[model samples]
Structures are given as C-alpha cells and as structure tokens.
Target: MTETTMPAAPGAVPHRTLPAGALPHDWRAVDEGWGRRGPDFATLSEPSACREYVALHHALGVDHGDHLLDVACGAGLAVELAALRGATCAGVDASARLVDVARVRSPEADLRVGDMHDLPWPDATFTVVSSFRGVWGTTPGALDEIRRVLVPGGRLGLTVWGHVKASPGAWALAPFRLAAEPQVRNQAAMTSLGRPGVGEAVLEAAGFVDVRRVRIPFAWEFADPATYARALASTGPAFVAIQEVGEPAFLAAAERGATAHVRAGLPLRAEVDVTGFLARTAAAR
Candidate 1:
C-alpha cells in the first residue's frame, strides 16, 4: 500500500506522516486497550521495562548529564528511569487517559498527550530520544521528527515488538483467537516486533547515523493459572481478548492448561523477542 504524508495538526502535538494508507482504521483498538488498564499495563511492564531502559543507557554510553525523552511512554517507567540517571526526562504519549494515570502514578516525570510524528519541543532539544513499542506504523515523516528533536551527537533508542511466533510470552495468544472485528484480528496477525525495524532503515532515512539493533529474548513466567491470569489482566489487549472469549473462569482454565507442562515454582515461560536499537542523531557532515 502507498503511504501518505501527514503533518502536525495544531498546538503542541506532533504530526505523524506514515506510509500506511489505512491508519485511520482501527486506531481505537490500541487506545481502548491501553485505557482500560493503563496502570496495570504500566505496572506489569515495570519489571522487564526497567532492565530494557537501563540497557539502553549503558549501550549508548550515555552519561547522567544528557537530556532524555521517551516517545509513547505508557506509564512513565522509562521516563522515571531517565530521571534517575540525572537527565532531564520527559515523555509524550497519544493516550490522554494513559498520560493522566502516568502523572498520578509517577509524579517525578513531566508527561503530555501528543503525537509522535510532530513533537512539541524545539529542534535538537534532547540528547537521547527513545521509544518503547510506539513506533509501529510510523508515517514517512515520523522519523524526521525523531531526528529533529535530538541534538547533534544525541542518540535515538527504540524497542520494537517481536513476532508472536518467536515470542514465547505470546504463545498462548497464538491459539486464543479474538472475536473482535475482522480488522482488529487481522492487525493482530500483521503486526510483529520486527514490523517496524524499530532499529533499521527508518533511522537511516531520518538522517541518523551509526544505527544498530540487537535481539534480546526474554520470558514471562507464571507459577500457575491463578498468577498467570492476574499477570495477563495487566495487558489491556490480552484482557479484552480473554474477556471476549469468556470470563475469568475460562481464561484461568486456559492458563492452567497452557501452564500444565511446567512444575510448581517454575513459571510457565512465555517468550518475547525484543530488538533494542541505538542510533546517533548527528549533523550531516
């Protein structure tokens, strides 16, 4: 499909210029998913999310003095960590409800509801700009905004979603089909962690240099069905999906069965493939 160019609307929000022709369709699915349990989603993501952000800092050899920005920060966890490292941390997200919850849950960071394509800040405002699970379906100009926001010599860090087939954490969802509209289900199948390159040519086209990405595999472990269900509820998308199939009883039972192969105290492992990338936003020589 041919992509279109979309600029910022108005005010402080950034404009997204995506190549996808059908973005207007089913945008609400993601919004509702995050809104239903933004807090739970944020908390559930806290564990691995922390390790991922810390690795970004170390991988880039970034110092505490640098200013950092997290694009599409769901609950401010990454923003919070950036602040801990002594950088001026800020987060921007499109979900108002999520941003509100983030403000209440994480008081240390400054967050706003905005688009990723056209950021509100001035050009070259940050030393490090990272995104977690937000760059999917990036428009043509979105990468340009990322480059425009970072100072020369700054680094852009991002994490892309891995394919569900490769990600064990998402294994259960493989068999569990959703009854949502056909479009939503189709989107589920079409999007993969590797979909956006979260670390590849986008940066190259956006004028960034030295782009690199690494594949990191991790697991989500649940001792049994009960614990797994609780953890599963934290994901807005998964919660709705499970609800659509049936109630908690059915979901719990499904979890129990999926986890049957594992012994007690040894959590059922769900594999996730995470690609972490770092690129330098440098002035063209």
Candidate 2:
C-alpha cells in the first residue's frame, strides 16, 4: 500500500528541541493528574496496554537493534517491555512525575518530558513509534511531527479505547460526561477513535499506509466502588470534570457509574475494548 511522504525540508523547518528541563505551560494540569495517578498507571494502565504489544511488535517486525520511540509513554512501561524484546528504546510523556517513574524503571532509556505535538527529536529518529491512548484529539501538527520523526517505512502503532457500544461496560463514560461541564473542550477525546474507521481515517490522513485495527480484550478491576471511582477520577478527562464540578461531585458520579459493573462481591470489573492501529510509512521516500 503506497502512502504519500512528507518531503524532508532540511533548513526550511528548523528542528525544534526543548531544554531538558523545559516543559509546556499548559502541561501543569496534565502533570498533576498523571503524577497523582502515576503509581496506578504503572500498576494498572501500563500493564494492560503492554500486554497487547506483542502482536504490535510482530506486525512491525521489531528487531534487536531497532530504535523505538514510545510517544506519550506514561511511566515508560511499554518502552521497558520493548527493551526486553531487544529493541533500543526512548520515550516521551507530558507528565514529569510519570517520566520520573519511567526513568527509574528504565534508567538506560532516553526518557523525556514533552508534549506529543512538539516532540523533542530530529527527523527520522526512530524505527518504530507507538502511542497507547495518547494520539486522540491531538492536532494535525502532532500527526505531522510523528511522521517527520519516523524513518522512511518506519512502523506506527496506536491504541484507543474501542467503541463503547462493543463493551459490556458501555455506560463507562456516562457519569464522567454527564458531570463534565458543557464548556469543557475536547471532552470527547477519550473515545475520539472509538468508532469504526475513525482511527484509520486519522492515520491515513497523516500519511500512514496499510492501516489495520484490532480489538484487544482488556478490563479494569477494582476491589470496590470507592477504589474504582478513585481510579476513574485519575484520568485526564476526570481532571477536567473535577475542575468543572469539583472532585467530590466527580467521584460521586464515578462511584455511581462504578456500581453498575461490580460483580460477585469480588471487585468492580469494567471490560475495556481497545482498538489498536498498525501502519507503515512509505518505503520509498
């Protein structure tokens, strides 16, 4: 499958790099949210996402020496997994605290704190790029930046929460959305690529080829409704909801949403449907 390539612009586009200590002004909110949830993400989210990366590695034909980049790589767990499979790894994330955890987890890795839209890398920097629930609602500029940093024919993989209709916990987002202020922008980002063909269209527009999607079985389990609510409240959108409606109200709504998924007095288990996309850039640049 042929794909259009973004011609290298050399001096025309000055490669932008951030100071190792520099971070975007708006990143504070994200940093705070993820920082608070860093341990949970490391214990819960990252493991769930990384469990599905084996297929992605196979599809991309990752090799021992391949340079891999995990965009929006929270806690660097995925990069650590890739390193286990023999790939050299680097990662970028918006949360300084999460990056700190990642640094400790993969001390040899080149982990950086930065926005996905303005990655701190030069052109053709990686052989494979992966983003787990990171690319949604990101601007076209971010997509361009992803393509720019990939070598010709480099593989790209992204995972988004699959369409809620396909999940048993279909009402998962109801409480959050219902409580979220109407003025909250990009509130739909959590499920932006959830619909059929939505993620593929976005990837193709960014010059990706051979785009394919697969649904992976994932579930979030919490010992009780309160724990479930707290976990849910840690998400980025939940942060927005907390800001709009306050944390107490937000967690109340989350608990209301969580009760529906509780089972057998064991735990509240919410089935998550994850849709992953794998595609490649054009080989002949």
Candidate 3:
C-alpha cells in the first residue's frame, strides 16, 4: 500500500525537529508521566512486559554482536538483559528519571533521553529495533523513524495490546478512557492491529516485509487492590487520567476498578492478551 502525507490539522502539535539529542517540548508530558513511575515500572510493568522482549529477541535471532535499539525503553531492564546475553544494547526514552534507572541497570549500554519520533542516532545504526508496548499503530511517523534508524533488512519487533474484549483485565482501561483526550483514548484502545491483517498492513506501509504477528500471554498480578491501583495509576494512560481528573480522583477511580477485579481471594489479576509483530525492512538500496 502507498503511504500518503497528510497536512497537519489546525493547532496540531508540530513535529519534533530538534537535534537528535535535544528534548522536544511536546514530549514533556511523556517524560514527566513515565518519570513519575520510574521506580515502580521496573518492578511492576517490566516483569510482565519483559516476556515480549525476550520473545522478540529470540524470534529475530539476536546475537552478541548485533546492535539492538530499544525505543521507549523504560528503566532499561530489557536492554540490560539483552546486553547480558551479549547483544550490543542501546535504548532511548522520553523520561529522564527512567533513563537514570536504566543507566544504573545497564551502565555500559548507551541509554539516552530522546523523542521516539526523532531518535538520537545516525541513520541505519542498528541491526534490530524493539519496542515493547511503546509504539502504537496510530503513530506511523514514529514507525518511519524506526525504519530510518534500522539498517536495511534490519528487523523490527513491536508489541501492542490484543483485542481488549478477549482480555480479562480490559476493565483496567476505564479510568484512562474516561479521562484522556479522544486521541489518547483511541490510541489506548489499540484497535488497529487487533484487526486481522491490519498490523501487517501498517508495517508494509512503513517499508517492511515478512510481517508477522504472534500472540503472547501477557498478564499482571498484584497482591492487593490498592497497590495494584496505585501502580496502574502510574503509567502513561493514568498520566492522562491524572491530568484530566487530578491524581486523587484518578487514584480513587483506579482503586474502584482494581477492586472489582479481585477474585477468589487471590490478588487482583489481569490477563492481558498481547500481540507481538515482527517485520524486516527492504534490503539496502
């Protein structure tokens, strides 16, 4: 499919044209949001999401000599693990606080704070690019950036939420959906790749081939409703909620939603159906 450029809407946020290492103003919220959750994300989000990273690395046949870049790499745990396994790992994120933690985790790895739309690297610098629960289908420009940074024929791995209807913890999105902007809510819904063939189509539009999607069991388990709620409220989605309704109101609503999921005297558990997509760029021209 041919991709067409669209003009920006009135008052739309301008694209980031800052130098590779400079921070974009629009990414401030992203930085602050993820930064606020820096510590917890390592313990809470990474545990569940790291499975996808491992799965992607194995699928792409990543090796010790390969240069791998993890975009929106929060807290750097995935990069640290990859480096341990011998891959020359690097990562970039909008959150400085999260990047700090990642530095401690992977001190030798090149970790930077930069916008995903304008990654900090020369073109075609990486053999593999991985983004776990980071890039959304709606952000084709970000995909283009990923494509630009990858060596020709380099592989890309992305994970997005699967069909929410099929997810047991779909209700966890209520606060975000209720409180976020329409665009943010739509992005959070993750409807694009959930549809048959849509994920492959998006990749193809971004100059990728051999696009494939694989289902993975992604889940989150919390020992208590209150703790779960607090953790949930720390993510990007909850950032939108907190901005809309303030942290106190957002936390109350999150707690209510989380408490509803408590079952069988067990901790609050959410079976998040996640899909990982893999694709390769065209060979270097």
Give the winner by lDDT: 3
Model 2, residue 72: what's the lDDT?
Answer: 76
TM-score for candidate 1: 0.76
Q: After superposition, how far is residue 30 of candidate 2 from its true place, in Å?
A: 1.9
Question: What are the per-residue Cα lDDT tens digits for candidate 1 across 71-168?
Answer: 87767777777776778777876566677766775676667666666676788888888876566543436677888888888888776656666564
Maximum-TM-score candidate = 3
**lDDT, candidate 3, at 238:** 71
Query: What digit string (tens of lDDT, one per residue) describes model 2 on residues 1-285?
Result: 000011111222221454665565656566776677777667654554445566566666777989999887878777888898899999987778888989999999999877677778898999899877676643445677788889999988877777666678766555556444442335454356657777888889889899998765566666888876766665666665677689888878888777766778586666767778888888974
Q: What's the distance in Å from true for residue 125, model 1? A: 1.0
| Whole-model lDDT per candidate | 0.61, 0.70, 0.73
User: Higher TM-score: candidate 2 or 3?
Assistant: 3
What is the clash tally of candidate 3? 1
**Superposed model 1: Cα runs more than 4 Å off:** 1-29, 137-141, 167-199, 239-257
Tens-digit lDDT track for model 3 on 118-153?
Answer: 676889999999887777655656788899989989
Q: Against the true structure, what is every candidate's RMSD?
A: 6.3, 5.8, 4.8
- In model 2, the Cα lDDT at residue 136 comes to 68
